[model samples]
Target: MMSGGNLSQYLAKSIAVMVFGSNDYINNYLLPSIYSSSYNYSPPDFANLLLNRYARQILALHSVGLRKFVVAGIGPLGCIPNQLATGQAPPGRCVDYVNQMLGTFNEGLRSLVNLLNGNHPGAIFVYGNTYGIFGDILNNPATYGKKILHFLN
Candidate 1:
């Protein structure tokens, strides 16, 4: 218990950055490669399941001590180089299904964040629009473009 100056201040001011939803939804639920979870739940139902779980985790943190949370949603999952390399889509294009599913998942995540912020007192939950930012970059690469990259490479 080394409270040199004030440990309560630090604990009270703690901010949690939760960046998830891509793996659980994309790898386990959305991918067509046949994941057990995917077979068990439909797209929308899977999105609900993921969002519900994420919200529970965030609320648990909120209940304990932390308040400010930066909850980041999934980006354009199917737009990566690997999906493009499947040869199923035209060059420099992404698989539409995965991207669409990601968007749906993001909507649920954003709504959950909003609901959490409303329910919790003095809790500041900032929903990180990861998908929006990446979508903008992909759509207008010249404006906001960076080479070399992600799950693809």
Candidate 2:
């Protein structure tokens, strides 16, 4: 049970930030040193599994009163410093395979958000182009007001 008030009543006026999906595939499945998620679950089927669960969660949130949502698409996991340090990709490039998976997941997430908006009345979902944003920062930090991408030695 909610403490302050009814969920639907409270959510009716709040903006929810939805950011999820990444670790399971990246750290767990994709990384060679970690658990093998690819062996257990393929991308297409795993995406479906995630969507089904995510939809239930969103609907639950909507049932409580949430009407507006800012859903952040997963960023470029392969381009992160740690991943780069792992030697999977060339020093100056992002891991294409991991990034490809993230892209596919982002596409599915976008579709899911659209589907949720269609099912729930008055719900607004804004898909943040985090992937694009991250890419810009990586390829050209100056565009986002930063001078350059500072790679650590």
Estimated TM-score for each candidate: 0.83, 0.85
Predicted candidate 2 versus true structure: per-residue lDDT over 15-87, tens digit per residue: 9898777666666666645666667677777766776777787777877778898888879888877677778
- Model 1 clash pairs are none
Estimate the TM-score for candidate 2: 0.85
For residues 69-153, write the lDDT of model 1, one tens digit per residue.
9999888877876566666666567778878877667888888888888888788999999988988876766675565343332
In model 1, which runs have C-alpha deviations exceeding 4 angstroms? 1-8, 30-34, 145-153
For candidate 2, list the clashing residue pairs, or say none.
7-64, 8-64, 8-65, 11-65, 12-65, 29-37
Q: What is the lDDT of residue 23 in candidate 1?
A: 77
lDDT of 1 at 21: 79
